[model samples]
Target chain A: MSAPLRVAVDRDACCGSGNCVRTAPEVFDQDDADGLVVLRQAEPPESEYDAVREAAYNCPAAAIEVTEP
Target chain B: MSDTLATNVPTYPFGNAGLEPLLPDLGADGVGRVQLPTGQQAWLFTRHEHLRELLRSADFSSDFTRPGFPLIRPIPEDMPRRPDGSLIRMDPPEHTKFRRMLTPEFMIKHIRTLEPLIRQTVVVALESMRAGGQPADLVEHFALPVPSMVICHLLGVPYADHDYFQERSRILLAWSSPPEQVRDAIEEMRDYLTRLIAARRDEPGEDLISRLAAERVATGEMTEEELVGLSVLLLIAGHETTSNMIGLSTLVLLKHPEQLRQLRERPELIDDTVEELLRYLTIVRTGLTRVAVTDTEVGGHRIAAGEGVIALLSAANRDADVFPDGEEFDLHRGSHQHMAFGFGIHQCIGQPLARAELRIALSEMITRLPGLALAVAPDDVRYRDAVVFGVQRLPVTW
Candidate 1:
């Protein structure tokens, strides 16, 4: 499995409230300049599996399209 | 389906558009226990009258931590709404205490004090646009700027950082925003607040943050996390919802040329008309989900203790029983206690602030640019679909 949870953001739809980045900092990074989410890693380390899942689930917009890689 | 929750099913929270005929389906005798594809049977509420009982009732709770909670999915083990358990995420007694600390700040009197300031800000934003020219992106020109500026001023945040803060607010709200983006924002913003708090501790300021840090919260009366959560919630809500309202309400007003004409003729109707727009738009989609404190009956079904309940505030507002012509957008209609600010103990604390901003923005447009109309066809305009109920771009002309 690449990353236990893979989350992709639809930048156009994001409001940059930063809940996902705070919940799963390892996987989700909000662009400080534009406030868009930037994937820090295409595939996160296995150790961060649970964190990624939490981030995806907590995403308010349900914008985090999660994948079990 | 590994991710059974994801499929051809409706992620559309308010799935159906033509709900006029479905009002009777939700009666005093209504009952619904649908089995989610996830194999969970959750009670559903879909009527107007009953929803009032459910929201204002002390029986239902917003605490999502309890067991057997009726939520389709958990609040993700990651984001603890209150890292230190803020009142916004808690139940009574403690919730009352925390709410009391902040409620006075939002009291009608305290909120009205900001109206003058709000009026000034709206004027500046509008004038800058009018002076610049006729064509403008309403979202950028009026909708986004006014709320962001007001929120920043209220929070003791330096206006210099408005761009960064606004940008962060945007991405964090993008549809399905990734965790990294949000986490980075939380940490960064928290750090900024920490520094701001330190400054207030040393010198104090005229904003809410200084008052909060100097008086009750920071003195061991409240934890650092609670303080952070409240500030962030206000910062987010203060601007996000109002910005959307400004944008959405503009569309609503412009759509019905007759109503817009009526409003232009009589600015006195702006307040009630704004409320009507709030109810009709219900733009702030449901992020506020509450868990059952104990076994409770609502919307004519039994929701067991610990089940999470998502209120369809907008749907509830449009209930035909509540509004004579619920779906119709009528500016002349009488008072409607719409759920735009939601119901319950956790109803939007910043609603007064949102309302004030809307009143100022809408009234200014009517008085200054009475000729305002959509520069592009309604369909051509874009909407930002995700965390907040708002349009992406609203191009307008006068």
Candidate 2:
């Protein structure tokens, strides 16, 4: 089995609409002015895997990633 | 037909087939005319120089107030997009006002702020593709989302609602889609935006939607209906056109390995490469249709008052005077004043943003994936049969 998953993001396309941070603030963050995403923790705990992937798939730009590394 | 191409005018879908390359030959005859399958007669003007002239011309009108003007559909009575008219679909006095306020936002300097954000989107989308580890529809996986996301943030619309709008946009824009269904989609979109406006009014924010609502634009300056129309225009114009460019540019570069090699070797050529791609693709298709406000002669052909001409931007970019051998995709060509974004006061306001998005996306692809080639044959990939120009599905694998 692989180790637990973590979140990575495509910062370019985030648009900073704040949906990801709204859904799972533990995994995502955004710049105050631009509202573009800034990863709070690049590799969150395994418990957060589902939330991270949901955010990735849900991203308007599809600019989110759930990484396992 | 305009009695000009009577002998050989291919109708509708077939008319589109031969249109991609006539950019140089804005016909000397009258603005070539065609009867769309819908029974709508729209004029086609092929050539870059004339497109520029008409865009800035006083005689050319953007007002659809007159009968038989070629707006895709009428604004529903319930949601009057413009009591008078929206800026984009209007002539000077109004068009100039909207651009004066909005142009600064899209100029190259201000738009550059979004680059870092764009690159982030690119990296994430690419990572997902790499992880999925399968041949994927690049259009859906990457091309479509980037601009929508970017525009959503720019407008302050909830990026969360991207899928909802994207689906509605697809329905509204699909070629074979029934006119009624497309109109229905527009209505649905208007309804959703109406609600968003209400919410923004209650809670003002920095997003584009909120700015309009908070500004109380309807209080003698501009109406809420016009604001909604502007939002829709920005969303559709900002995303769809840019998406097609991305897909088409990728397809062309993949087909011409030599050009790709040249770019990979000289990374600095990416900016010019992107401009060349825009000039080459001219993907927006027919220039925004304009009616003749007064009798005028364009390219020595008389356009009678009340008649609108579809200034064929694609054809204009190909004019031999404007561009030599315009058919050839020459990245090194120093052709700057290209009408890819349009001309005059009515020129495309979102060009700076569009250019930024494409330059980043294309250059990054070249620099990162040196061996990238299409997973499937170009012939198999589907180009949309849009009255508007676009690729339907571009499936690619590296």
Task: Give the top-scoring candidate (lDDT).
Answer: 2
Docking class of 2: incorrect
lDDT of 1 at B11: 30
Q: How far is candidate 2 from the true structure (C-alpha RMSD, Å)?
A: 15.7
How well does chain B match by TM-score in each candidate? 0.88, 0.89
**Prediction 2 TM-score vs. true:** 0.77
Which numbered prediction scores highest in TM-score against the true structure?
Answer: 2
Candidate 1, B31-122: lDDT as tens digits: 34434433444445556666667766677776645554444332334653442434556776666556656655664446678999999999
lDDT of 1 by residue, A1-69 (tens): 243555577764443435456567777876644445678875677788777776664443345676787
Docking class of 1: incorrect
**To one decimal, what is the Cα RMSD in angstroms of model 1 from the true structure?**
18.2
Give per-residue CA lDDT, model 2, range A1-69, as digits (tens): 666676667754443334466457788865544445678888787777777776664453456777665
Question: Fnat of each prediction?
Answer: 0.00, 0.00
TM score of chain A per candidate: 0.79, 0.81
